[model samples]
Target chain A: MSVTKKDVNYVADLARLKLSEEETESLANDMNQILDYMTTLEELDTSDVEPLEHVIDLEYRLRDDKAKEPLSHEDALKNAPDADTDYFRVPRVIE
Target chain B: MSSSVNDNYEAVIGLEVHAQLLTESKAFAPVSTEFGGSPNTQVSPLCLGHPGTLPVLNENLVRYIIKMGLATNCDIARKSIFARKNYFYPDLPKGYQISQYDTPICHDGHIDITTDGVDKKIGITRIHMEEDAGKSIHDQDPFNTLIDLNRAGVPLIEIVSEPDIRSAKEAYEYLKRIKQIVQYLEICDGNMEEGSLRCDANVSVRPKGREEFGTRTELKNMNSFRNVERAIDFEIERQIELIESGGKVVQQTLLWDANKMETRMMRSKEEAHDYRYFPEPDIPPVVVTDEMLEDIKEELPEMPDVRKQRFIDEFDMSDDDAQTLTEDRYLADFYEEVLLHAGNPKAVSNLILTEVLRTLNDRSIGIKEFPISEERLAGLVQLREDDKINSSAMTEIYNAMLEEEKTAEELAKEMNLVQVSDTDFLEPIVDEVIEQHPDEVERYRNGKKGLIGFFIGQVMQRSQGKANPEMVREMISDRLEQE
Candidate 1:
């Protein structure tokens, strides 16, 4: 129910984020407060109510399995941080 | 590192198969799901995990998984929710993959497999739909891993099995059954070499009568069915040796190096899969109604098991023969279609097993791609069945029909491969063979009955392979027995 410093660091690591000591502390505090605030809703005993997966009540939206035009290789890689002619280059991934 | 297989210990293996759905579009995007395209050319913004992009479900993805579930006898979930599994990898751009965690779409299914002639039912833990990650090419580049996003959002169904597989061969059979069912449904192409279908194994070892399971290791990067079997065999051996040497097995992920035939630790990758999964908020729950089940059931083709059993029962063929004939839907259909025209199940099956399958393997093509059709092949089998041509003549006619557009009989006549079954046509050849081989005939008359094979061979050679060996045997016996 509470966010610890190690939890914040672990989550930051998973998200590939590097946080300073100050940012980590503040983020932990903020997340704990948010969790504490959200915990109040749990006290209402809404166990009888149905759990909704999404906020919107619309029907399940599905599309036909038809291919549409995709972005060209150039347009697709235009925003990559580092890319070669055909691939997005990244640090070596050890298998 | 094994001192032979430890019979005191048994292996426990469970497979997780990821089958890429054969849909035209990506799972959550409308971009093409075509394989072998130029790198990243078939990707869309949503597939690339662009900001402010939302994913819509593909209708066919759900339907295909449902068909597989039904084929595997899974209890179709009335309602299923998608979940986000948080992780970090170069191939996964979303940082979190949209998967099914708590609520899978299909569950409690079972697949029956035969390992060493022992029929066993491997329980299905669950089958869930998810999207595929992009390709990561590590060996292609010198320093960095090259990534292609074309396969990022392609549809996939992950089939998880219960830990019922107790041997490497059982794992092989279980994987084969899964592949057969998916291919039979026409949902997945089941091509493992090109990454259309992939399997991961969790292997462990336990004492023969132990009630509890030992620590398990997850194996990845096995690209072929044979590799899957070998990797599991290696893992089982390694784990058993580790325990026998007073060493404890560690629960971690291992990568199977097929070249070296060993499993190595995938260090630092183990920490990346804590996978804090939660219900996906973007896509709503997919509800499967009764009507949907009925419609999909009607659309489901005859599964491999049913068709295989029918081949055994109705066609009166052996289990191995029926199995070979029904290995694929198209192959089985070709068998029946040929039978419909040829009217003899046994001969048609024999031709298919030997001649047809050899052609399929030799050309590395499927039944659909092979030059001969069912009707044409049936004509060939009918010739052999009606005794117009012998088996070798049938083979010759079949090979000639591959290049020519003529029927089997036409090609048989053109190549002088038709069988000579007439008593008048074959009597002289038989008589000539006996007269020429008088010394052998004397031995044959003195009760060396096996020399009849030599006599038949000579007669066949003299007639240029047109003499029916069975008929020649009868005619030669009648003349040789004149006492």
Candidate 2:
């Protein structure tokens, strides 16, 4: 369950994080130490221990299922980084 | 026609729904879950997955999830734990999402869904709590995308159902039922367009009598119920054709292309071992006490299914009518409140489900925002019952009621909605109309029984439609018999 420099580099690329080689190596050590500490739970016998799922047990709080008014086109596109007359358009999203 | 070949094929369908809980707060932090706020304004240190921050449980979220479990008849676990579903995505600032893996909150439940007059039970495998990741804006450039953390850390309950569905219609009905139940329970707003509720379907095919499962492809990005079923159907047929041609159906994740009405592969599927799931240590194990469970159970409200059954038995309403009213909780509650005042459950159900619902849908308005209150709606129904106005005139009154703040009685008085009661005063108008239309009156006297309605229409028209329809009919029939 330990993280290595290779693991750090792999995750960085997957998440599109542009990290320097030295930074990747440093993070690998830090993550590995954290993982090592977390493994302490594995040493405790949890075979019979039930996993806790929710903080409390309650059932069925329902709101009426009706469609509320949707945002107007102008209000919806108000915060778009780039916009045209109507649609929120950025640079070429797809080729 | 290959009828026998069609009989040999079976459709296996399963649903994976991601329901964003309608809690006031975020999943693991105290940040508000309000929709449409400033970007990243709701983010807390823990939500951003900062190094020093840890997640504290939001009690309301747990109550919400448990409520869902109860509605679905799920087994509520006394304890549950969070695990890291290891995945690397830009929007997921934590690198790995904290979710329930092996030990889900509830499991082994079933729900009954009706499609085309047939009822079937769909098995629920698990309902687990998970924190959602943010959105990736891939529209930035040809090779890159930006990330929005506003959606990140939103709480979600993923309800995974067993592949018991057979046809596209059945899948649609099952999805609708799930949406209804969750919305009725107030756990989720059930807004597909807003990404508050989302569904992913797994489709596969097998030869008749085959016990082994066929290779399944997962479909995503279905914003509507129709799209969910259509995407599954198209994918199933595609797999069937491919398999019949001796090609293997690849196991992968595919995104639904709404424009092309097809599914394209996003990535090859990965096994559980690939991401390396493990217990999340940053958060402690969640514990559920008996007292908390009891409090939640006691607070559970009436679900739609039960309420529908009650409406049918108590109100003597038709199944179709009851189903329509109870499908939306607000409409059902509105009907109930009006019945409490009007004392005519059947009539209230009909007017609300048919006339009121039609008006609401036509205007694209919500029941909550309807200017007509329950008391006023009941008053309208009562007026009709008391012979104060005819059904035709009731529509105008109802419409006017929406724009007018006055009560139904007040509006009736203001608009002169009272029916004509004096037969002596009506006798002259009826006689004048009969004398003026001698040909129609002669036709009616010569056994043109249907013409009686025409004569009554003339009287009502002369009275400006405020005449009591029953009294007008009585007067017209009596005068016709004499002629």
Candidate 3:
């Protein structure tokens, strides 16, 4: 399971990251190493083992349907990079 | 042009509908899930993806999904797991959506719909719970997109249907049935324009005899049921045209432009999201116990199909009328309530189908907002049944009732719209009509039996529309015939 330069670029595009050619090459190598390390699990022959989804065995810790108070508009947008009135402003995205 | 184009090809369509649940709070946060709040005011630390906050599943969310599952006859999974679908967008504050990936809560359900009087079953592939993303308003500003996190943590259930729909009309029927079921269960409001209920269709076309499936494209941006049908039709035609012109159908995502009535490419498969899903660690797995299933099943309201059948059998309604009446839960309830008072199902159904529905459409209000009470409507129908009012008089009284705050009987009396069936009172008016229209009376005696209608009309007009038309007819005929 080796990661190629094209795979790295495709993933980077999906993540909306801007990477240079040099960085792309270096990232490809780094991802391939991680993939190779993950391949070690395939060597284990545990055909009967059930796949684990979570570390804990807990189930159904739920809250009631009643609503609680939420943040004020100012508090919610306090940490935003840019805000206008009551909205967080970002670069225009065409549909 | 369409016949030749569609003759050799057949369309295959499947729809994915996202219905936002009417839960009081966010799926995992305590923040209010109500729509139309000021921007960002509905946000909580858990919904905003603050570092230290953890998510707690909402009990009502689970119950709502189970209700849907039972309504659609889906097999509720004994154990279901929530997974984090990793994606990045400004509106997705967590950089991932908590959704059901491999282990959906419900599966293998089938919904029956009728198209052209033929029943067809569309298979439900799966129904999974998820959280919604926030709104991004692009047209609000010239250079910036505004984000509102009010909807970010709202609960949703995505219903995926099998590719069993054969045409645009079938797809339309199937979507309507889905909406009806959700609305019946009271889990979702089923308002497409408000974004509470949204749909995306997967459409493809193939030669009529081909057994293998053709390449398909996913269509989005259709906000209404009509748009969904139109978009599927347009996509099917576009695919067939491309194939006939020696071009291959490419799988992609397209947006339906309702104004232009065409679908434009949004993105191709290469740009599709590879949502790397992993089990959600913050929230635990949901287990449906036998008791829980029983409770949900008992609480499930009668679905649309069953109610439609009962209407046909019980009320002796036609299939079409029954279908229309049961399309909305509230409308069906209103029909039953009127039936209790009127004691005549067919008459009530007809009045509701024609008069009540017309009024509702004119005012753009639902049955919930209709001004006339069930008892009042039933009284109006009863008046007509009892020969107390003619059809025209009934219509007049009904229209007047809409404007006045009075019962049907009160309105009938105030407007002088009741039929005067008393022979003693109508005989004088009938004799006067006969005496004045001697030419018509002579014609009536000469076997021009249709002139009886003219005499009746004159008597009714003289009585200001209060004369019983049938009694007037009998008297006019007898008086003219007497030597």
Top candidate on DockQ is 1
What is the CA-based DockQ of model 2? 0.09
Deviating ranges (above 4 Å) for candidate 3: A2-45, B267-271, B362-365, B422-424, B481-483
Query: How well is each residue in B1-483 modelled by candidate 1, as lDDT tens digits?
Result: 534558788888999999999999999999998889999899888878888999999999999999999888899998899999887788898888888998899999998999888999999999999999999999988899999998898999999999999988998898888888888898988888888889999999998899899999999999999999999999998888888889999998999999999999876553646788888999999988898889999998887878889988998889999888788777887888887899988888888888888988999888889898778888998898889888788888989878887899888888898888888888878778777888987898899998878888888888999988888888888888884
DockQ of each candidate's interface versus the true one?
0.84, 0.09, 0.73
TM-score of candidate 3 relative to the true fold: 0.92
Instruction: For each candidate in turn, give its C-alpha RMSD to the true structure in angstroms.
Output: 2.9, 6.6, 2.8
Q: After superposition, how far is residue B143 of candidate 3 from its true place, in Å?
A: 2.1
Candidate 3 lDDT by residue in tens digits, B1-483: 468878999898989999999999999988899888878899997777788888889988899998988888799999899999988788998899999999999999998988998998899999999999999998989999999989998999999999999999999999888888888999998988888999999999989999999999999999999999999989988999899989999888899999999999875554567897889988778999998889888998888878999999998889999989999999999999998899889899989999999999999888999999999999999999999999899999989888887888888899888889888888788777777877876777888988777877888899999988888877777788885
CA lDDT of each prediction against the hidden true structure: 0.88, 0.79, 0.89
Instruction: Show where candidate 1 strays beyond 4 Å.
Output: B1-5, B270-272, B358-371, B401-406, B421-455, B470-483
TM-score values for chain B across all models = 0.89, 0.93, 0.94
Local distance difference test, candidate 2: 0.79
List, residue by residue over B1-483, the lDDT tens digit for candidate 2.
245755777889899998998877777776667777655555665655667877766777678888889889899887777788877555677879989888888888989998889999999999999988876666554554555466777789999999998877888998888888887887887777778889998888899899888998888999988888888878877887887779999888899988899989875433323566777776666666788889999888898878989988988888888888898777788888998889888778778877888889889776877778999899999998888888887888898988888777787778876777788768888888988998987888888889878888888888888777678888888877874
The CAPRI quality class of candidate 3 comes to medium
